[model samples]
Target: MARTGEFLMALDEGMLAYFREMADEMVARFGIPRAEAVARINRAYAGQEFEPYPDLMCHELPEYWAYGLYFKPNAGRLPDDDPDTDLSAWEVRPAPPAGSPAWTLEA
Candidate 1:
């Protein structure tokens, strides 16, 4: 894992694409403006605790559940979870405190 600034700057292309795809899907499905969708995605990343496992990423939308993203060890690929699903139906949960174990997972 690199420094936060460096990690973001050097983000894997696939990872960045995944983020963008998710954000775009949010915009199309939820009717949010592009800027707001992008901001929400950025906020999700910014709100995460990366110190424990920098490669593991977690993002939470308040009262809207959370999700994890990471390359499976040695597989070099992301999981096939459906990011296109309508997440609005999910129960809302408060965002976990920074550094909380709930937001940390082994990469």
Candidate 2:
């Protein structure tokens, strides 16, 4: 594992826990099987190189919505955006499934 100086540690147990939680949320919200969700999550972080600050891992699900997992120091504060409206929350949420009419809305 390359050192980032900020925290010279690889994906440790805590990071794995966060990943697992995110995966489980994906399964519940997206109704995808556990194995597939886990794979998607893995792919999101597979080739990602470490950064001095937190790393944001993102994966596009079957639907139009995307999943983002933020890996950072717990002691440090995350952004203060409103959680309800913010899609970048720590946990993934369910969006309209694929083929839903919501996708056709004009931006």
Q: State which candidate has the highest TM-score.
A: 2
Q: Compared with the true structure, what per-residue lDDT tens digits does model 1 show for residues 1-107?
A: 23222122224554455455665665555565555454444445654433332244425332121132211122332223377754454443233344543332221
**Shift of residue 87 alpha carbon in model 1, Å:** 8.6
Q: Considering summed lDDT, which 10 consecutive residues are worst modelled in model 2?
A: 57-66
What stretches of model 2 exceed 4 Å from their correct place?
1-10, 49-107
Global local distance difference test of model 1: 0.40
TM-score of 2: 0.40
**Per-residue lDDT of model 2, residues 61-81, tens digit only:** 222221343222234543232
